[model samples]
Target: MPTQIVNIKDQLFENIFDHAPNGVAIVGLDFRWVKVNQSLMDLLGYSEEEFYAMTFPDITHKDDVAADMELLGQLLNGAINRYQIEKRYFHKTGKVIWGLLSVSFERSPIDGAPLYFISQIVDITRQKEMIGQMNAITNIANIQNEKLKNFAHIATHDIRTHLGNLGVISGFMEEELEVLKNNENFLMLKEALSQLESTIDNLNEVRKSDFSTEERMTSLNLKDFVDSAIYNINAIARHEQCKLINEVDGTFNVMAVAVYLDSVILNLLTNAIKYSSKERQSYVHLRSLESEDYIILEVHDNGMGIDMEVHQAELFQFKKTFHNRADARGIGLFLTKNHVESMGGKITVESRVDVGTTFRVFLRKA
Candidate 1:
């Protein structure tokens, strides 16, 4: 009965070892394979007989052999009891396979002499391939972003020079030909030139936010900032027959890049006023709400609201216009969104056609 029980225990151990999920092997002190499980053979694309005839160094990637041998030497010298390393192996079919290899030294029961090694290999080839793919994609995106920055710099410099020259020429013509100043075609040319200049300015603003490397954030009182924005835009609001109201709490503070916050506020306020409905009493209202990590600034307006179903996808895109307004360059919301996101915040909108629009700007809490 004692002998039978011992045999049963050995069978159970063998079953667990042979059916292990990862590759398992027993290697002789001479680095030759003493025994290998089915998983090890499958992992290296070799039969058990072939693996038994070979040594680990024979299948190891040439570049990895030295490092693996050094670790084994440490284990042999009793410097380390066990070791693990990420190494490559050459499959029988000539492909490289990545593996997480864990190994421990075994000793003879009575003599305490070196016996063999127990090794476990977890295949990590798929994970390694996925990491490589992600790194490649990130590199491509960085290259394209750099190219865009360079293009923006060149376009801003060269185009501004040409626009300056046109402005000078237009001023000269206006001064010398008073009769042509009133001509319909000449008036149209002036308007077009003005619009072009405004567009270039908008492009420069967008470029600044998009490529700004260091964004310095400071704590700002939400109400004070909203008041300042309303003060600056008061003339335009009044001219458009739109009332500007500040409903933000006086004590609410937020963390934001100052220039970016200012731009975001001004853009939302101006757009609200600019697109106000003629059929109603137009008003732009500013308020705030608090979340655990963010302070939300809500700018609601009784304006000519957007058809979100039709224009939601392009709402914040460059030069994308939803309404037919002569002054609509479509840069305001785009720049605002860029500014908000650059500061680690986000902007969202809610609107109903001919009823109202509300822009919610989320900022980090101070």
Candidate 2:
């Protein structure tokens, strides 16, 4: 009766494990597969015999090996009970497989030594590919925008010089041709000069409205700035059920224009709340990292992610709106990028639709 009960329980476990929705596998301490379910086999395009003979390393991407190995080492050292990472693997046909790998450490029942790894892999290949395409699109747009700025500078300078010359000639005509002062022709010239002056004023406004390539930078306490920004944006976050968190270390500061820093943080935080996911409670997290030469500020959000394939190019274009939100003028990111680059910094974005978005700004450390 004892034997029969044990067999029945094993059968029940097998049934549940086989029909599981996700790919599940167990690898022994020898780095050989001890067990793998059907879903894992289908996901990897390998048969039971093939997978059983292979080790996990045979399928992992080369670039991800060190990180994965490090995590495994931590688990074995008892530094962590489990580790999770979004990593890449090689498919059977030599294609890339992006998987969110969740690994838990197990120990031998007899000797209490490290035994095996239980891995649950969820395929995120599509999400990774979409982000890659979006990055390409954004790069092209940035290049074009740079060209447009150069063109504008040249065009504005030439137009301003021409207008100044026209004004001078009109003044000389009004003084020398006295009788013509009352004539419609003289009046028309006067009107033309007035219009030219107005045009130059408009051009100057445009120049001031965008970031100046030569804006002055100052040392800024990133933590203070972030705190102030969050304080100001709290009501909206509360209304949206969005929590804004600051995890920046207190020791680091950056070389940034103070006014622009305020605007960038506020605008990004607003967008984070504005496009929040309805499926869960939303969050906007701010964190910073320090390197030898750069301070990296990352603004992360769990929001209604962008359809990057369709909207990446126009994401930072002035007046280019992507979402149906009435307040999305599309100028915020444009100005944010302009201000960041103007202060000798760089910005990048990575996102997965319906998952989240992360904006990374790299600036010189002060």
Candidate 3:
């Protein structure tokens, strides 16, 4: 009677273990599976007998073994009572199985020594697939954006060039027929030619822009570039009585692609000259300094400053002209912004009406 009672109790415990919702496993200190429930067998596409013959390390993915062992070592040292982690395992049919694995330990009855490890596994393969899909979508979007920028450059440059040649031909006609210029159709043609010329100039700026932010950069001397920009804008600076001061130290260097940096500097300098304050002797100063993460260059000018409250939002937008100058093609600052960003830098302006404007560019430190 006693033997029959013991057998019945054992069968009841076995039935309960087999019917558990999650895959339950028992591993010994040797990292060998001592017992595995039916759930684990089905999830891994392996028979219970095959699992018993294989050790935990044999089934674990190679990339995950080191981390698994480290945590197991911690548990054995009594540092943690239990551990739960998401890990990858190899399935029997050669596919990857992502498992949420939870492990704990049981002690021996006599000496309280760890006798075995108990684990529960949950399949998370669908979640991993979803994350991979999201990454693929993000890559596609980045590629599309690059293609669009290239298309804009090609369309603007090609059309603008054709229009520019036509305007030149029209200008020649003006000199050829001074008497005919007074005619209504002749005046209208001249006005249209002038507008087309301005559009072409603006398109030329974007045509010269650099749109690749991933280009490898060389170290550029801050003062050298500033000097070159001043040289390019010398005539306007002289006309405005603007003093071009290169105060940046000779030793300061930043990482940038050369042509992009040149365009950005020239644009800012020209803007300073164009808007110089008439009330005072105008000055544009080029200075640079090193910060924690960036090399900063500042173009400080005492100029007819912008109304930040009004035109702030459109400051660097393409064709966004605020000052009503006839030659304000409205493309310099826009191209300046694009080139600055392409070289892993950013541009910002601080201005108050009648006070002055400061354009600050933050570049990658070499």
Candidate 4:
């Protein structure tokens, strides 16, 4: 009865080892296969007889052999009891496949003599391929972003020169025809030119605030920045009959580029006041909220809110306007969004037509 029980235990061990899902093998110190399960044979596309005649180095990718040997040497010298690595193996079909190889050794219990190695391999070919694809996409996007920066720089320089010459010519015309200065059409043209110049200046500011890999960020007090924005925009807020309220906490600081942060805050505040509702008491409120990774600054307003259902898609697009106001050049939100994102932040909006709008800017917590 004792002998039968021992046999049953041995059979159970063999069954469990052989039916394991991942490749499993017992290898000698020479790295030669001494025993292998069906999974191991199927993984490397080899038969039991073939595997026995071949050493692990025979199937290992040539480039990976050196690292594999180095780690194996550590294990052999008792420097490590086990090791794991991502390695490539050449299949019988002459193709390379990726595997996560984990190896440890068995030793004689009485004398502590190294016996053989137990290697388990799990296929990671699909995951490696997916990582490669994502890397390629990231590279492409980086290249495109750099190109956009260069284009904006060049365009701003050239357009500014042309506008300067046009401005000079317009001045000459106005002086030569003094009566024309008072004409409504002439005034309109001059106002349009002035607006164009302002638009270009905004674009240049946006270009200047573009983030670069080497640019260092500074820690800024959120409340201080909000206060500065409110001070500068006070005249406009008063002119528009909109109240400005600052609720950002003094304790909260954010990592940001100074010019970029200023532009983002000012734009949101100005927009809120500019679009304030005429039917009710209008106010623009600024506040901040905290998260583990980000400081969310919010600008809320009771304004002539956007019809989000209709303009959501075009909200942040350049030259896309949702309002009929003469000052609505449609680039404020566009520039604001660019500035926020360039600083490794993000912007989102929530609005209801004729009700109110809230703009949230998420910045890295300092």
130: Cα error in model 1, Å: 2.1
Give the per-residue lDDT digits (tens) of candidate 4, residues 1-366.
Answer: 599998999899798779999999999998999999998889889999999999999999999999999998999898998999999999999988899999999999889989999999999999999999999999999999899989998998898898888888989999999898898666655665665576577567657775561265689888987876676666667778898888899999999876678778888988888888899999988889998889999999989999998999999999998889887898889999988888788999999999999999999998
- Candidate 1 local lDDT, residue 232: 65
lDDT of 3 at 328: 94
Ranking by TM-score: 1, 4, 2, 3
Cα-based lDDT for every prediction: 0.88, 0.82, 0.83, 0.87
Off by over 4 Å in 3: 1-17, 108-111, 177-366
List the candidates ranked by lDDT, beginning with the highest. Answer: 1, 4, 3, 2
Show where candidate 2 strays beyond 4 Å: 1-13, 109-111, 208-366
**189-292: candidate 1 lDDT, tens digit per residue:** 66657655765675676677744524457788888778767766666777899988788989899887666777799899888988899998899888899999
Instruction: Give me the overall lDDT of model 3.
Output: 0.83
Candidate 1: Cα lDDT at 327:
76
Task: Give, for candidate 2, the lowest lDDT window spanning 10 residues.
Answer: 207-216
Model 4 RMSD in Å is 7.7
Among these predictions, the greatest lDDT belongs to 1
**Candidate 2 residue-wise lDDT, 1-366, digit = tens:** 599998999899788778888788888766788899998888888889989989888899888988989998898889999988998878788888899999996787789888778888898889999999999999999999889777877887888888888888878877997887899656755664664465456455555466453445668889887876776667678888898889988788888776677777877888889989999988999999987888998999988788788888877888887668876777888998887887788888887788999999888899
31-150: candidate 3 lDDT, tens digit per residue: 999998988988898898899899998989999989988989999999999999999989999999999999999988899899999989999889988998998999998898789778
Q: Model 4: which ten-residue window has the lowest total lDDT?
A: 208-217
Q: For every model in order, what is the number of clashing pairs?
A: 0, 0, 0, 0
- Which regions of candidate 1 fall more than 4 Å away from where they truly are? 1-5, 141-215, 221-253, 278-281, 287-296, 307-348, 362-366
Q: Model 4 residue 347 lDDT?
A: 93
lDDT of 4 at 293: 89
Model 4: what TM-score?
0.60
